[model samples]
Target: MSWGFWRNWSIGTRMACIAMLPVVLLFASFMGYSWYSHRIQVDEELAERGRVLARALAETSEYNVISGNLSDLRLTIRGLVQSDASIYRVDIVDSSGHGLASVVSETALAPQRLQYGAPIRKQVIWINLFSDNGTPHITAPSDIRPPTVTTTNVGEVRVTMSPTYLLGKQARRFRVELAIAALALAASGVLAFLLARSLAVPLQEAIHALRAIRGGNYKVKLPVSTGGEVGDLQASIGDMAIALNLSKQDLENKVAERTRDLLASRNEALRADADKRKLIQKVNSIVEDERKSIAIEIHDELNASLIAARLESQSIAALAGKLNAATPAPEIEEIRLKAQAITKLTLDLYASGRRLVRRLRPEVLEMLGLHGAVEEMLRHYDSGSGCSFTFHSEGDFSRLGHDLAISAYRIVQEALSNVMKHAHAAHAQVSLVLQDDVLRIAVADDGAGFDPVLSSEGIGIIGMRERVYALAGTMAVHSTPGAGTEVGIVLPLEDRVNVS
Candidate 1:
């Protein structure tokens, strides 16, 4: 097919052009070297043959009787000349410069130079021989030039030859070699381009597929109109796209379902949270109402009854005192002991009621601030137990909100109770500090600690957790089997700390 101007000058052409450039330089070298080398080789062979003939002729002892027998010399020279195909003739001339015998055709003694393709010009060999005192010297025939040789006492021999046939054969061979080189070079260029395209095009297609995938077009398929490594790469890209598409579809479906499920679950969770808060508030109200009633009843009715018993004891003692001395000493002693026992029972009952009231609602928490209340509680604990507990506080306690105060007191109270019940602690440290807009409350005990994991279900721990959670505060209970228990809480005291 004929190539278009632009098409002829495509990548292949450029490649072919580039490929041809080296070949052209090599071909030029081949041309110069081949011609020079062939000519030199041919001349060397021809000159060598001529030297052999001259040696053969000289070796013949044609003595001074040469005036009689020129025939033997002529025959010997002719025999040597006839051995080579390129040698067309051999002639011996006597020292007097007269031709004795001619082995070459008279006309063939002079031939023309061989031309390559310029009209099958004659291919020739011209020869000249020199003799000095019956010794012969031979030089080969040459077309372009010849060497000057003088003789002494011997004859001159001239031979003509034709190398036209050999030249013709070489010409044909050179033409064949040229054609083969051209075809081989052109074929190699084409093959190289195809190889390059094979790799480059697939890489390009793979890149495009990747771009498409990046652009959210996961369905884009890589082209597979290829074979070998490129085809494998395309197939791999196809697999990747398929996987990406599946993953994208899966994510999309899950996202949709998750969105729906989250909405429904959130609604239910909201309702549950509201119900739970309501339930908790109701329980708190009921418990607080009951506590108030119980506190009032114990202080009024029960405590008044104890006071009445005490008054009765006093009256009995007065009567006993009035009776005095020897009137039924046993009966009087009995009355006195009875009065003393009544007074002791009433005091114990009042103290017991006060303990119950504090447990139910630490009234001191409201009356005194956290520090004072905690101090009082520690004093009670210290009196009851032989353990020394230290309390430290900072910031204005009165500025704390009511709810925060209660929760903090409760958490501290619960923590202390845990220490007393579970810790078997020797001593405890309660440090309350205000730092960075948050109150950090820490209760560390040097005691035989309990396992926090096992203790988590304990009521005191549960209550502490609930209180902290309600206030959006954090509580960390650190305890090891042997080391000790530290209950710490960081509460945001951003309440009405700036109270009027």
Candidate 2:
């Protein structure tokens, strides 16, 4: 009845209706067209038949008209009417508009009857006789030609034909056409219903599985092999369900492992006070390893997934841009805006994840060695921190082992973090110098310095000192209330270098 009603219909019903409606309409139109076309053709044929009958009557009545024999003319007309049932009436009129002979049928005229007229012309017969010398001479027969040079029109003959037979035949054909159309429509409906059912059954099953998944049942699956969009969707959903189930299991296992590790660590802490330094270092190493793992996970999985989502959103935006939307439907523009916003948000999320991973562990530290890594860090801070940092280095830190290089990098990083968090200064500098057997580095910030005697060292400063000590190095903190703070470290190069 309406589009809304159709929308409420089940998929099977809708599909059946959609499939059969066009077929039924086509069959009906074809039947009507066939009937109308046949009727037009039949009418044309009947008119032609009437015209031919009138012409023949006019030709046969020529002698009757010349002889003024009304009886014979009437008999000819009656004979013609008797010959063809459709010939309802015939009339012969002289040139003076006087009717000489007429014959009428007992049948009543049809609603739309055929009438035709033909003019009667006197026909001349020329007799050719052989002369005595075998030459030809022509003679005309009597008053029909009267030695005239051309034919003469004597009168007009009119014939009227009833179209009752044509109508009857057309009615019979229409009935046949109706019967055929009905049969075809019935067959098409049956076929459409079967096809729709075939599609809908599998599709309904897939839909049920989707609903189960929505209800948090990841075990639900559909093995429908329709080999179409539905099939692809089914496969994708099944894969997603399995993947989600695995992830859920993995997460639960991880939580249990972490709980056990926490209990073990608590016990170890209570049992070992003399090995506090070793425990602290071990904890630091564990934390660093976990950070690296987390960063890798974020980079590998989260970042990739976000980037993919962003690209998909961008593709959607591009497609939307290409669409013709001179006059969009309701909510179309809103949807377009939402798509663009989603793309933007996805991009933001990807950038943020990358920044997080970079902060957790600088990949450049592994790629370009310690010198390049420290320089890159300073450059990044100089650009982002609103404070100018000048870095100066002497000798190659790249020659150091990973542990030594990483310790140096961490000290510098901690010093910078202190500057950024506590320093109310605009200028900072970092120095890495290798002189003789010792490696020296200092990070100094021109800030409102705190009196080292009265101020307590922050965790960052303590951590840096511990790192320097763990490397068997000495660290110095120099600061005054008015002047800037300088954090410096010195390490012997013997233990850090490997000859091989």
**Best candidate according to TM-score:** 1
Q: Candidate 2: lDDT of 484?
A: 88
lDDT per model, in order? 0.70, 0.80
RMSD values, in order shown: 14.0, 34.4
lDDT digits (tens) for residues 20-92 of candidate 2: 9899789978987988888887789779888898888887888889999989788777876777767678888
| Highest lDDT against the true fold, candidate | 2
The lowest-lDDT stretch of 10 consecutive residues in candidate 1 is: 114-123
- Which stretches of model 2 miss by more than 4 angstroms? 1-274, 322-327, 384-386, 498-500
